[model samples]
Target: MAAQLNHTIVWCSNRSASAKFLTEMLGRPAPTHFGHFDVVELDNGVSLDFADANAQIQPQHYAFLISEADFDAVFSRIKDRGLEYSADPMGSRAGEINHNDGGRGVYFRDPDGHYLEVITRPYGSSG
Candidate 1:
C-alpha cells in the first residue's frame, strides 16, 4: 500500500463556529461531535478535525483538487460570501490565477484565516 494523507488537525479559537462554517462552506454536513472537538470529512475519506484550545492559532493552508463543475460551484459560493480571494497561491493580489507548472488554481481564506485552494490540475507539466 502507498502512503497517503489520512487527516489534518485544525486548531480553532471558536471550535463550533469554525466547524459549522467549514462544514457549510465545503457543502458537507457538520462534523460529528467528539469530546470537545469536531471532525469534517473530505471526499477522499480524509478528515479535517477541529479543536479548541487556549492558545494562538496559526492558520494552515489546505488545498483541494476539484473538477471544473465543482470549481464553478465553489467559486460561486466564495463570491457570494464576499470573501477575498486570489488566483495565486502566494496571495499576492486579488483575482489572479497562477498557471504555474501548467495547472490552474486559485487561493482563498476561511473564517479562521486558514488558507484554502482549489486546483483543476496538478502542479508541473508532464506533456
Candidate 2:
C-alpha cells in the first residue's frame, strides 16, 4: 500500500484556539471536537489533531501547498491581522515573501509560536 500522511498531533497551550487559527488561515471549515482533540480536516483528508500540552510545548512547523488564489488569500489574512512574517523558514527575511520555485511562499507563526508556511509551489518542483 502506498504510504500517505494520515494525521499529526499539534501540541498547543489552547488546542481549540490553535486549531481555529489554522482553519481560519487556510480557509478551512471550523474544527470539530473529538476525544480531547480539536480535529481540523484538510482537503487532502489529512487531519491535524490539536491537543493541549501537559508539559512545555516545543513549537513545530506546518506547511501548506496551496494554489495561487489561496496563497493570496492567506497572505492577505496574515497581513490584515498585522502578523509578522518572513520569507525564509529560519525567519531571517522578515516582512517578505519568497518567490521560490517561481511560486509565492510566506512564513508566519501561530499564537503558540508554531511556524506556519503557505506555498503555492512545492520545494524542488520546477517552476
Candidate 3:
C-alpha cells in the first residue's frame, strides 16, 4: 500500500447530532459506544470520527469518490434535506458543477459546516 488513508477525525460542535447526520447521510449505522466520540465507517474502510468540542472548529473540505448509484442516492438525500449544494467541491453557489480536471462532482456542507463532496472519477485521471 502506498500512503493509504487511515481515518479522519472531525471535531464537531455536537457529537450526537453530527454523528446522526453522517450516519443517515452515508446510510450507515452510528458507532456502538465510544468514550466521547462516534465512529462512522465508510465502504472504503476509512472512518470519520465525531468528537464534541467547545472551541470554534475551522471548517474543512473532505471529498469521497462514489459510484454513480451512490452519488444519485446521496444527492437525493441532500435534496430531501433541502440543503444547499454546489456543483463545485469548494461549495460555491448553488447548482454549479466545477468540471475541475473534467469529472462529475457535487458539494454539500455537513451539519458542522464541513464541506463534503462526491465525485465519479478521480482527479488527474485520463478518463
Candidates' C-alpha lDDT: 0.79, 0.95, 0.79
Tens-digit lDDT track of model 2 for 45-117: 9999999999998989999999999998999999999999999998899999999999999999999999999
How much lDDT does candidate 1 score? 0.79
**Pick by lDDT: 1 or 2, better one:** 2
Arrange candidates by TM-score, highest first: which order? Answer: 2, 1, 3
lDDT of residue 40 for candidate 1? 87
Where model 1 places Cα greater than 4 Å from the true spot, the runs are: 99-103
lDDT of 1 at 92: 76
**lDDT score at residue 116, model 2, on the 0-100 scale:** 95
Candidate 2 ranges beyond 4 A from true positions: none
Worst 10 residues of 1 by lDDT: 96-105
| Residue 40 displacement in candidate 3 (angstroms) | 0.2
Q: Residue-wise lDDT of candidate 1 within 1-119, one digit each (tens)?
A: 89988877888888888888777766788788877778888889998888985888888988887776777777888889988889876677687666655666778887789898888
Task: Enumerate residue pairs that collide in model 2.
Answer: none
lDDT leader: 2
How do the predictions measure up, each by TM-score? 0.85, 0.97, 0.85
Best candidate (score: TM-score):
2
- Models sorted by lDDT, best on top: 2, 1, 3
lDDT of 3 at 45: 83
